[model samples]
Target chain A: MNKLLKNSLRFVLFLLVQTLILNQIEIGFGIQLMIYPLFIMLLSFDTGVLSLLAISFTLGICIDAFSNTFGLHTSSLLVFSFLRPVIFKLFDSREGYDLLLEPTVLNMGNGWFIKSFGSLLLIHHFWFYLLEMFKLNDMGYVLQKTVYSLPLSFFLCVLLQYLFVNKQYTK
Target chain B: MRNFIAFIKHFRNVLIFALLQGIALSLYFTFVQFPRTQYLTTAASIQGSILEARNGITKHFNLSKNNVRLQKENIELLEELPKSFIKLEGKLVKIDDTLHRQQYEYIPGIIINSTHSKRENYFTLNIGSSQGIKRGMGVFSTNGIVGVIHNTSEHYAVIKTCLTKKLNTSIMLEKTGQQGFLEWDGVNARKGSMTGVSNDLKIKKWAKVVTRGGGGIFPRGLPVGKISRVEVVEGESLWDLTMIFAEDFRKVQNVYIIKNLLLDEQRDIEKQTDYEDQE
Candidate 1:
């Protein structure tokens, strides 16, 4: 399969699986597995910032449609896409600018990838939940939701990246 | 001109990204209109069905407790029946005894799905259109008002619960008759705030609150909750009051759908007023 076609197919599959399957699994106590961000994180490093933003927007809107909230997911996804490049720069290795390489635990090393992915996942979850409770008067509630959702989303994203990215196993 | 052309050529991707983002935002705004859109609601229906099925299993243990509560409510209603009869004595007595029908009826239903986690939460009932359930009807548990019917399918109906931020129930102080709008702040399921109350009204703690019937959705004098706390916002002429809901929505099993016969006429009058305003 062509590289672009393959990536597009993966993006659609991830979105469908996330919306139709993963979102349904609420293990009680506010822990929901958020795997939608994996699509944006798996794109090749050389992918243009514009394309990344567009893809993120599309993914977010699709999820938002299913969730029945207007602009909340789209705005959060836009923020995540906007910050992805900065996150990459912060965790960049000494041997930078590898055009052939994508974001994978094998290529980027598990330690750096986990840290970067965790930060981005936190950002996405925070914005998403905050936008969701837009009219809430209590900041404490917002903080609580963000704190509870971040780790769950981070773990899910990392696990998905490791499992499907065909990367070398790293402890 | 050359620099401008070169810039456009070099950063075309950024422009495309911005365009796509704009399109996405527009689409979000367009399709994500709340309380509407079949696509989103269909998903909610599916989720509601699954949750309802799960709740049905878990709630089996609570059946005995629910029965006890229902019995208590039945006793209370029987006690109130004489008072209602006394109140309606002059108006209803003059009518032919056999010709007059019951003014109001309550149909018992079970909440199959409920959510307190989201800002705009909705629940599903086991009774629906087939059971004479329709959109715009009111729902209440034995304790107090629960919510209003949002949409209805064949055997199920979606109810936007009182806990939802999008819900606003017209309410008043039972003692003072001061009207206000009750809305949930999307944080607590057990509590919400009553806005639009004038500062002049002496809103004491634990004052009885009930539906004002101003909205035409709920009948007059349905129990809402008691005023837990009252605060006069600084520099504002309105008092913000918190209410501890009378009904425990978390354990809500059976609910009564309040079908008001006068709803269509009221709605038509309101629509005419809106039309006049537009003109």
Candidate 2:
């Protein structure tokens, strides 16, 4: 499949799945499972920060519109995209990155993927809940939501990648 | 100019990040207080239709439960019909009287999309301006009050459900007639708080609470909830009260939008009073 076509299809799939399916499943305790950030993570390594910000903004706005959240998702996703390059640099391997390779767990290996994606997801979820509450009094609840949601969202995003992404042939 | 250009190039990504973040945050803060437009909300045509299509499939999941609830309401209405009562004395009663006139109209709608978990939750209804839905109209299910219409498009409307902060619907205790305003603590959907009622009034546990209809948005005597907990404010005369909502918002599918026929007249009269007081 052509790269652009495949990525576009993934974009739509992530949007619908996040809004239509995951948004509906409210398990209480402020545990909202967000997997859309995975789409941001899976982009090609060579993608520019400008395109990343634009893509995240678009994706966030679509999700916010569907969920009646106005711009909460957009703001959080923008922060996620803005910090993506910084986090990538912090966790960059000794030999540097392969520019052609997409940032998938299958391509990036388990340890490197976990280190980078885990921090990014943490920052995204924490910023989201904090901004959603926007009160110092409810700081405990914000942290609680972040703690409960991070692992579940992490697991779900990992599961989605494993189910969908094709392994590169070694032969 | 070249130095300035170099400066811009040095922090291009940061500048773009700040620009987008500013737009997003401003949109969030402004819309949280008042919905200025339906374009970014679920009441928009495209979002509404998409939600409606999703509801078309998911509504069947609760089909049996909702049908039973509808049937129960039908039986209640059936029991109130003139035919259900026996005429013992054959007394003539006037069918039409000048003493009372119709003042409220209800438009039925199905909820296409809703969220119970957000700090400021809003539900999108399947009806809109084309069906006579206007902003600030009251909405309620058969069991209890749902919310007020927050925004509307041509074909859809968004409801500001009671689960959000600052709902502030005027309500009174059924037993004592002590009035207060409704509030949600953003913790539990089934539970909400009421403010302004005095600590001196003895409120019974499980006492019914109903709308006072002071705002003309909802009619008086509509069931709001039952008192579940009450505590004294440490330094104030007001009672800190909590109640279990009559309507379980999670399972609520059907609702009615109330259009008060005399709202304009009431507003006009109130405006006159305010003008006189100012003078």
Candidate 3:
């Protein structure tokens, strides 16, 4: 399959699965499955930053429309999209990573993938809750939601990367 | 000038990102309508369709609670009817039979659709014009008043619940007769505030408050709730009072439509007063 077509297909599938299936699975006590960020994580290193930011905003708006929360998701998603390149630079190998291969365990190795994905996940979750509880009155609730949701989403993201991405990159 | 241009080019994506975000945020804060307002016109149609599919699932889960509530309401009606009948019989002996029949009538109803999670909440009941429910009639559960009828169709009527910030009722402390306007503060579903009460009125914790009959909508002396807290503002003359509602709106399954016997006559008299003032 053509690289652009394959990535685009993944994007649509991730949106559908996240909105329809994962959103419904509110694993007890307000901890929700936010697998939508997987789409940004799976993008190739060569993907233009502008296009990534646009796609992130679009995805966030689409989720916001369905969830009845208008702009909370969009702002959070844009912040993460803009920060992605900086996060990637910190974890980039001196030998220079393959541009064609996306950030998956199969391509990036488990240790490097975990560090990169964890940082991005924390940034995304923190901004998401901060924007949701916009008022200073809800600072406690914002912290609680961010702390609770981040680790669980990170674990799920890692589990998914391990299962789908090939095992050869574990070294 | 060239350095500034280079700086702009370097951060052009950030600028566009900020601009788009600003637009989205402004639209969200300003253009977006209140949940109930949008639900009444455009979104209600979509929600109605979605709810239709989920109705069976909710119905099955709500059956036990619904049956218990219905059974309790049945018992309360059975207990109240005999006393009401006796009162009616005594009045009939003095008044003409034609006039006696018009004084008392009960309309039974079921809540078909309801929502309580918004700033302005509303419910649609299954009894309407055909069932003698007219617009402007008051709806009450066995516990106390729920809401007033807003719009009515042939078989259904929409009720704007007291929980709505737009709804205000005249209520007074049963002990001191300190009257005030009661309104929901757009927060807790089970609690509301009563303003305009004189600060001098000794409003103790759990003091009883009821409808003052100042408004023709609710009959005087209907039980509202007990005062939970009272706070007097530093400079204001009235007390800020919160009441713990006697009726749990979340569990309401059955309600009665209050058909005021003298509504038309009362309205006519008010209209005449206005006309005379105009002269």
Assess each prediction's global lDDT (C-alpha) against the native: 0.75, 0.93, 0.70
Q: In candidate 1, how many Å is residue A7 off?
A: 9.4
- How well does candidate 2 reproduce the true complex, by DockQ? 0.87
Tens-place lDDT digits, model 3, residues A27-55 = 43335568778788888877878888888
Task: Please identify model 1 stretches exceeding 4 Å from their true place.
Answer: A1-35, A39-62, A97-107, A133-148, A155-171, B1-36, B42-113, B124-134, B151-157, B268-279
True lDDT of residue B185, candidate 1? 77
List the candidates ranked by TM-score, beginning with the highest: 2, 1, 3
> Which of the numbered candidates is closest to the native, going by highest lDDT?
2
lDDT of 1: 0.75
Which candidate leads in DockQ? 2
Going through the candidates in order, what is the number of backbone clashes in each? Answer: 0, 0, 0
Task: Report how closely model 1 matches the true complex, as a DockQ value.
Answer: 0.30
Q: Tell me each candidate's i-RMS in Å.
A: 4.6, 0.6, 6.0
**Best model per TM-score:** 2
TM-score of chain B, candidate 3? 0.71
TM of chain B, each: 0.78, 0.97, 0.71
Clashing pairs in 1: none
Write one digit per residue (lDDT tens) for candidate 1, span A82-168. Answer: 788889998777877476667876677779877887888889887777666654575677778778877777777777766776753
Answer with 1 or 2, whichever has the higher DockQ.
Answer: 2
